[model samples]
Target: MPAGGAAAGLVAGAATFVLMPFERVMPPLADGLPDRALWPSVILVAVLAATVFVAVWRTGEPAQGFVALLCAGAVGCAVIAALGDAAWLLFPDRMPDIVPLNAGPPPVRHALSRMEAQDAYVAAIVWGGLLVAVLAAVIRPVTRRRTAALRTLTFAFAALTSVAAAAGGKSEAVLAALAAIVCGMLTPATAARAGLPDRPASTAAGD
Candidate 1:
């Protein structure tokens, strides 16, 4: 699990670097940047889900883990959709002028307007927080020494998601919050089965 977490972190970090310039040049909320930028994260989530499913299946906890994975996927998708909706609703007047996803690079002189830029910033913060929460939840079991910290962080991310939902009126934020909570709970269970010291419960449960 440690190895897996390291690998995922490396990959995600690399991807972020590669995308940084593009993100700077293009508003994250503009065009398909939000969708396109999220592809790597989605892939990571899928891979982690599959890994957890297989691990749980091997340990005879297939049903629970599988359900968790499905819920995670649904929640993640809902979050993405809600974020997109929020971006659109953030500035209704600018919706028509917003660059289309396939319109090629926006003219250099035509950068995101002030309101659009603000929305883009908010989108980045929200999505980035979600990604961190997802990764932390997925890798918490293998984190050793830091499991408690990670768990706290995951809950904090969920709280932030809830706040975002309220401010943005994005229902998906609620789903994402629920998903984070579920993942936090499931991590310890799955880790206990896998013989990882995810938390005190694993030791106390005598698994």
Candidate 2:
């Protein structure tokens, strides 16, 4: 159960970290709704924290692995966000070149300067690594058959919502709703295999 919970936590933490930068950059869907833009990322963090808490309480053990995973996630996100922010700081004048949308003539397209392009490339690589981690976590055996299936489904939904929040460029309300659904589906099982009492097999009667 510890192993399974840790794996889930790691994946969730990675997703949260990788998507942090994009969340920061994404603007509110409308005026007077600044908090909506941050709901998805906030929900992810809250869910991860709750998962760690459950793992610790049910297993009656400290979730060191989960803690370490969260620490790594925080550091990774900070570094990536710093890199992007640095690029913007260094080339403040070139920032406007990287528009989210292009309203120009034919061949309507987004544009980015070399620095912005590099930053975006780095972001993509980070996101790719996170994706691989999430896939591995989903396939790994975490609990008994039934609980494992539920966990897998929950994690998959979380991964999808995080991706949509980061890349879909959709409305904040939509992202928030997706996040809420993922949270709703992520209720951990009460009786994990590790927490269950071991039972002895019955012996044959022909002794």
Using lDDT as the measure, the top candidate is 1
Q: lDDT by residue for model 1 over 36-145, one digit each (tens)?
A: 66776566656665655554665576544543443344334334434444544665454434445554455421343323434433354345446446545554244343
**Candidate 2 residue lDDT tens string, 96-172:** 44444454542232233433444543443344334323433433233344444544554555465456547743233
Candidate 1 residue pairs that clash? none
Residue 18 of candidate 1: its Cα lDDT?
Answer: 33
lDDT, residue 79, candidate 1: 42
Prediction-by-prediction clash tally: 0, 0
After superposition, the stretches of candidate 2 with alpha carbons farther than 4 Å from their true spots are 1-34, 64-207
* Every candidate's lDDT: 0.47, 0.42
**By summed lDDT, which 10 consecutive residues of candidate 2 come out lowest?**
198-207
Off by over 4 Å in 1: 1-53, 67-145, 168-207
Could you tell me the lDDT of residue 128 within candidate 1? 42
Per-model TM-score, in order, reads 0.33, 0.30
Q: TM-score of the candidate numbered 2? A: 0.30
